[model samples]
Every structure is written in C-alpha cells, then in structure tokens.
Target: MKVGIAGLGTMGRVHAEAYRRMGANLVAVYDANPDRLAGFAAEFDVEAAASYELLLRQVDVVDVCTPTFTHLEMAETAFALGVDVILEKPLALTVEQGEQIIRAAREAGRRLFVAMVVRFFPQYRRAAELVRAGELGRVSVVRLKRVGFLPAAGWFRDPEKSGGMPVDLMIHDLDYARWLLGEPVSVMARRSPALSGQALEHVQALLAFPGGEMALVEGGWAYPPGYFRTGFDIAGDKGLIEWSSDQPEPLRTLFPKDEPPPALGLPMAGLEEDPYELELRHALAALESGGPFEVTPEDALAALKLALAVRESAASGRVVEVA
Candidate 1:
C-alpha cells in the first residue's frame, strides 16, 4: 500500500519509520513546517509533498499524525478522496468532530483506523486477551497509570490544542480500561492545578463500569524531564495480573490453588519491537486484507467521549455520567 504521512513531528516520524520497517511504499510526506518536512523527506528518502492535498492525492492511505485539533479536517479530506486514514489518538478535540470524521469515512467507504497504540503493547494486549478468555474471571478492579514528563512541544500545553493532560495523556489508559472492561457508566476525576507559569498537570479518574467493574486510571505531566512510567494491576475473582515498567519482569500472575495460571510468554526487555510499529503494521494488514482494525473509528470516538467526560468531571467536581 502506498502511504503518505502528514505532520512531520515526533509521531509523524515514528509512523514513517514503521511504514519503512513494514516495507510499505512510503510515497510522500507533508508538514506545515517546510524545514521539518524537507528534513524528514531527506532522511526517509520520500517525496515532500507541497501540501496536505498533494500528499492525499499521492497515497492510498494518509497517516494523520498532526495535532488533535487538525485530525478531523485532514481525515475528512482523505475520506472524501476515498483514501483510508490512520489517525492518532484523541481522534479529535471534540466528540462531534470525531463523529463527523466517522461519517465521512462511512460515506467514502474507506477504512478508518485509529492509532491507539496502547492496545498493541505486549503486556496490555495479553491482559486484555486473558480477561476476554476468562482467565481473570469476573474482573472487579483495574488500576492503570501512565505518567511522564511534559511534552517539549508548546502546543501540548494548550487546552484548546491538546485538551490538557487528561484528554491528551490519560486517554490511553482510559481507552484501555474501556477495552478491557466496557463502556464506563460514570466517571469521577480530580486534577492538580496547573502551576503558575508551568504546564505540568496531573489527573486521576475513577471509571465505574456497567458490571460493577471499576478502573482507577491516572496520567500526568508532572515528572521530571526524561522521566516516564506506566503500569497496570488487574484483580478478579480467579486471579490477579500485574505489570510495571519499573519491574524487571514484564508481567506477574497469581491464581488460586485449584486454578492454573494461563501460559504467557514475555517479550525480552529492550529487545521487543516498538508497539507503534506493530500497531501500524496491524493497521496496514487490516487495510490490505479487508479485516477489522484493532481500534475502529467508533472505538476511537468512544474513547474521546470518555476523555471529554473526564475533563468535565474534573472541572465540575462531580461525577459525570458517560453516555
């Protein structure tokens, strides 16, 4: 498949590398910043499209790696041209825009894959698989944490652009929680005040699921520069599964004496391929085989709704009912 990347930023470069690794035809790339676009094109040996429109015309798929605010417009254009799209997370700044993108794709009859890379991470994928297979029978509680240093990009600090930390960062775990459990019935959240003249923020959200399942999801940009951490804890009637980035082991499981733990092979530390690359490969494979994407456009919209609810709950100091 011929692929063209939009937005020559960190994620844009990542997608380009993944496509190269997968041996896809990377025909073109575009960026608002000419210097970055030229540099990326030179580095990847791909054509630098004069504009997003030219890039759309050049490839079968357009990878929208631009900011959250730019997703809907770029996706709509690609869909209108009967080209598939791979959109980055938080699909859009608002649910309405996300729905519009979905509608455009439906009308265009093109595949719309949302890049929710968390779903591709080895440990997270294993946990979800085990939950679905009933290895973690009747799951009651899940705890997820994804905290890291503030992004160097100034746009990430702007609420209008990135939707703050909850919508931008926490949405990963929020989406994962929904994928593992189900749609959250309600969400209650708290966020640390953005310090004066500082962009750092933190949020902790409690999601109540329909079957009495609960998820404590937290994310932030309060860590020191270059610091990052993530982990998960899932508890159920039959067993418990845990994984932390700080731990030497990738995952740990405990089961009752009568119940044997499910067999799981861990990826070698520092040797596993990047989850972003895996996610892109899966998306392209689905596109080629006409299979379902791991993260559907509707799934992306649902995650956006939940993220918006988290923001609302944090601002209102009240539990927000998720529709």
Candidate 2:
C-alpha cells in the first residue's frame, strides 16, 4: 500500500522508518513545519508534500502521527477521500471527537487502526494471551506502572493539545487494563494538580470490573530527565505473572506448589525490531488482507472512555462510572 505520513515529529519519523524497514512504498510526508518536513523527506528520500491535502491526494493510506488535537480533522479528510487511516493513541483529545472519527471511517468504508503500541510489546502481549488462555485463572488484581521523563515537545505539556498525562501517557495502560480485565464499571482516581509553569503531573487510578477484578493503574511524566520505566504485576487464582523494565528479565511466571507449570516460551529480552514497527506492520498487513486489526477503532474508543473517566474522577475527587 502507498502510505503518506502527516507530522514529521518523533512518531512521524518512527512510522516512516517502520515503513521503510518493511519495504513498503512510503510515497510522501508532510509536517506543519516546513523545515522539519524537508529534513525528514530528505532523510527518507520521499516527496515532501506542500500541505496535508496534497499529501492526502497522493497516498492510499494516511498515517496521522500529528498531535492528539489534530487527529480528528486529518482523519476526517482522509476518510472523506476514501483513504484509510492509522492514527496514534488517545485517538482524539475528547471522546466526542473520537466518535466522530469512527463515524467518518464507517461512512467512508475504510479501515481505522489506532496505534496502541503497548499491545504489540512481547511481555504485555504474552500476559494478555495467558489471561485469555486461563493460565492465570480468574485474575483478581493487576497493578501497572508507566512513568517517564517529560516529553521534549512543548505541545505535550499543553492540556489542550495532548490531553495532558492522564490521556496521553496513561491511556496505554488504561487500554491494556481494559483489554485484560474487560470493560471497567467505574473509576476512582487522584492526580497532582498542575502547578504554575509545570510540565509534570501524576495520576493513580483504580478501575473496578465485574467479577471483582480490579486494576491499579499509574502513569505520569514526573520522573527526572532522561528516565523512564514501566512494569506490571498480575495475580490470579492459579498463578502469577510479572515484569519490570528495570529488571534483567522481561517476564516471570510462577505457579503454586503441586501445580504443574505450563510450558511457555517467553522472551527474556526485548525484540530486535521496534514495537512501533511491529504495530505498523500489523496494521498494513491487516489493511492489505482485509483482516480485522489487533487494536480496533472501538477498542480505542473504549480506552479513551476509561481515560476520560479517570480524568474526571481525579478532578472531582469522586468515582466516575464508565458508560
């Protein structure tokens, strides 16, 4: 498929590299900043479109790697032209806009794949699979932590542009939690207030699911510069699974005494290829084969719903029900 990228920032370059690695046709790229667009096009040896409209006309698929606020407008334009879209996470700054994007895709009859890259990570993927296979029978508790240094991009610090930490950074685990435990019934959360000229905010959320399943999710940009970490601990009736980025092993599984442990081949280290690359390749293949995507538009919407509820709960100091 001929793909064109919008926004020549970090994610835009990442997607371009992935397409190149897969030997796919990356026809063109566009960015609001002309200098960045030119540099990226030169580096990738692709045409630099003068504007988003021109780029849209040149490719069969448009990858919207722009900021969270720009997603809906770019996606709507692509769908209007019968072009498929690969959108980055948070889908949109608001649930209403996310719904609009979904509606546009349905009307245009084009596939909309949202890049929730955490799902493609080996450890997280294995955990979800084992949960589905009942290796971790009747999961009772899940604790997830994703904290990192502030983004270099100033836009990320702006609540209007990126939906701040709760929506942008936290949504990954929120989505993954929903993927593991099913839809949450309610959410209660607490967040540090954004201080004057502060770029960091921390949030801790509790999600309640049916069958007494609970998830404690924490995400933020509160760490010191150049530091990032992610980890998860999941417990069930039969066994336990855990992993931490700070640890040497990527995954660990334990079973109770007298219970025969299942034979599972888990990756002790990270994959050779970037998870973003794997995610984009999967989207492209699904687009080509007319197969269902791993991260569906509806799944993205559900994740967004949960994230927004968490934001509300934190702000109001009350539990918010997920509709």
Candidate 3:
C-alpha cells in the first residue's frame, strides 16, 4: 500500500522512518516547508510533494502529521480524494473540528485512525491485559503522571496550535485512564495558573467513573531541572502494577513478595517489535484487510472529550460532565 506522509515534523519523520522500516511504501510526503521534509526525504527514499494536493493524489493512505489546527483540512481533503487517514493525536484543534472530520470520514466511507501510540506500547498493552483479565482485581485507583521538560517553545506553548499540555501531552494518559476505568462522568482539574506570561503549565485532573473506579492524571511541563520522565501506577484490590515508561522493569507488589520486579520488554518497542515499526505493520495490515486500525476515530474522540472536559473543569473551577 502506498502511504503519503504530510507534515514532516518530528513525529512525521519518526512515523515515516517507521513505515520505511516496516517495508511499507512511502510514496510521497507533504510539508508546507520544503526544509522540513528535506532531511526526511533524504533519510527515506520518498518523494516530497510540493503541495498537499499532489501528495493526496499520489498515495492511498495519508498520515496527517501536522499540528491539531491543520488536521481537519488534510483529513477532509484526503477522505474526499479516497485516501484513508492516520491522524496524529488530539485529532483536531477543537471537539467541533474533530467531530466534523469524523463525520466527513463516515460520509466518505473512509477509515480514520488516530495515532494514540501509547495504546500500542507493550507495557500499556500488558497493563490493559492484566486489568481486563482481572489479575489486578477490582481496580481502585489509577494515577498517571507525565512530568518532564516541555517540548521546544513553538506552537506548543500556544493554546491554538498545540492546545496546551492538557490536549497535547496529557491526552494520552487521560484516554488510557478512560479506557482502563469506565468513561468518566465528570472531571475536576486545577492548573498552575498561567505561568511566565504563557499558557497554563501544570495540570491535575480528577476523574469520577462508574463501578467505583477513580483516576487521577497529572501532566505538565513541570519537571526537575534536566531529566524527563513519564509513568503510570495502577492500584487494585489484588495488587498494584506500575510501569515506569523509562525504567527497565515492571514494578509490581502482590503483598507476599519483596523481590525485584520482572523484566518488561521495552514499551517503546512491541512484544518483539519496535513500537514505531509495529505501528507501521498494524496500519499496513489494517489497510490491506480493509479493517479499522487499532485506534478508531471514536477512541480519539474519547481522548479528546476527556481532555476537553478537563480543560473545562480547570477553566470554570467546576466539575464538567463528560459525554
């Protein structure tokens, strides 16, 4: 299958490399800036499209790697041109825009897969398995923390393109929390008051779920000077499962053993595959089989809904009901 990559940013480049590594055809790439796609084109033997229209005409699948603000246009254009889409996280700048993209895809009978890459991470997969299998036993509380150095000050600091850390970064953990626990009925969040004359920096969200499961997600640019870290700890009646995204082992406690944890295959890769390569393989497999990718537009919508609810809660200082 021919895949066209749009937006030759860091993620675009990473995904393009992944597609190439998976042996999928990277037929064309489109980026508004020629310089952005230059290195990626050189690294991977894919032709860079001077315009998005050219890229859409050249490939059957388009990965919308641009920022959230631009997703709707590319997604609509691609679907209109009979090209399926692989949209980056936080599908669009706003829920209304994301909803419109989903609507267009359904009307066009096109598939839209959101790149919530963490779902494909082996550690997260295993954690989900444990939760589903009841090995964790009656999940009580889930706390996901993503605290690290912020991305370079660009659209990231701006609430328009990047959508702040709540939508840009924390949306992952928020979605995972919703997936692990049931859908949140309401959320309350507190932000660290707009800092440095910029957008809000740190955010803490409390989610109330059915079946007595509650989750707390904290995401921010607040990290100790120098290092970066992201991890989640889940607690249940039977035991607790902790996977530090950067650590070498799975942290677990069964209340009977004090031994060191088991070695968990790196989450960056799959059980026996690199995560990015696995993403490529899955996308290819799904496309060939005429099936939906692992992450559906609904899943992306859920993540976005949760993220927006958190933002509303933070901004209004009241519990915002999630739909």
Q: Which candidate is the best by TM-score?
A: 2
Model 3 misplaced regions, further than 4 Å: 224-226, 250-272
lDDT against true structure, model 1: 0.89
Task: Give candidate 3's error at residue 119 in angstroms.
Answer: 0.6
- What digit string (tens of lDDT, one per residue) describes model 1 on residues 207-264? 9988888999999999999999999999998899999999987678888888655764
| Candidate 2 residue-wise lDDT at 186 | 96
lDDT of 2 by residue, 1-323 (tens): 99999988888888888889889999999998999889899999999999999999999999999999889999999999889999989899898999999999998898899999999988899888788888888899999999998898889988899988889999999999988989999999999876678878889999999778999999989889989999999999999999999988768898898987766556655655588888998999999999989899999999998888998999899999999
> What is candidate 3's lDDT per residue for 1-323, written digit by digit as tens?
78899988888878877886777888988888878677677778778787999989998899888888888888999999999988889898788998999999999988888888878777777888777877666898999988776676478877878877889989999989977886888899998876677554788999998676789999888765566677888888767778776877744434336544334322533365567777667877887898767778888888998898888888898989887
Q: In what order do the candidates fall by TM-score, top score first?
A: 2, 1, 3
Instruction: Report clashes for each candidate as comma-separated counts.
Output: 0, 0, 1
User: What's every prediction's RMSD, in angstroms?
Assistant: 1.7, 1.4, 3.0
Candidate whose lDDT is highest: 2
Model 1 residue 104 lDDT score: 89
The candidate with the higher lDDT, 2 or 3, is 2
